[model samples]
Target: MYIITVEYVIDPGHMLTFMDAVLENAETSLHKEQGCVQFDVSQSHDNPTQFFLYEQFVDEVAFQQHVESEHYLTFSQKVQPAVVSKSVRHWYSC
Candidate 1:
């Protein structure tokens, strides 16, 4: 599987809005994309403004499709302003 991990530090003022948009994006991706295998969202225990996403796709093409998806685009645009800092990493199953 192609794996993607994303970490975000969100602006505190936009936490609730960011949460809603992210959850909706996750749900939509899982339901709409055949290549999306897993999509997990996590929040830091110590810092409510920090969030993480763990995503798995069938292959690199699948992961590409995910980034091009409408839901993802919407999520990205919607949350861009609310993000303080972000990091993304990619991997593949052995």
Candidate 2:
């Protein structure tokens, strides 16, 4: 499996809207995408503006397909203005 971890620093005032968009993205991935193994969204206890997304796919191609999906594109557009910073990491299961 291939895993992607994304850290997002959202604008404090836009937290609710950002959460909505990201939640939709996660839901769509898990429910609609055949290649998606798992999708998890988490909020930092110490930082209200911080969010983490853990996504697991069958392989790298699955991840690429996810990026090309319409739901993800919409989510990206919706949350772009609300994000202050973002970081991503990739890993392969042993």
Off by over 4 Å in 1: none
| TM-scores for the candidates | 0.98, 0.98
lDDT of 1 by residue, 1-94 (tens): 9999999999999999899999999999899999998999999999999999999999999999999988899999999999999999999899
Shift of residue 90 alpha carbon in model 1, Å: 0.4
Q: Candidate 2: give the clashing pairs.
A: none
Clashing pairs in 1: none
**TM-score, prediction 1:** 0.98
Range of the 10 consecutive residues with the lowest summed lDDT in candidate 1? 62-71
Q: Against the unseen true structure, what C-alpha lDDT does each candidate score?
A: 0.96, 0.96
Q: What lDDT score is found at residue 10 in candidate 2?
A: 97
Candidate 2 CA-lDDT value: 0.96
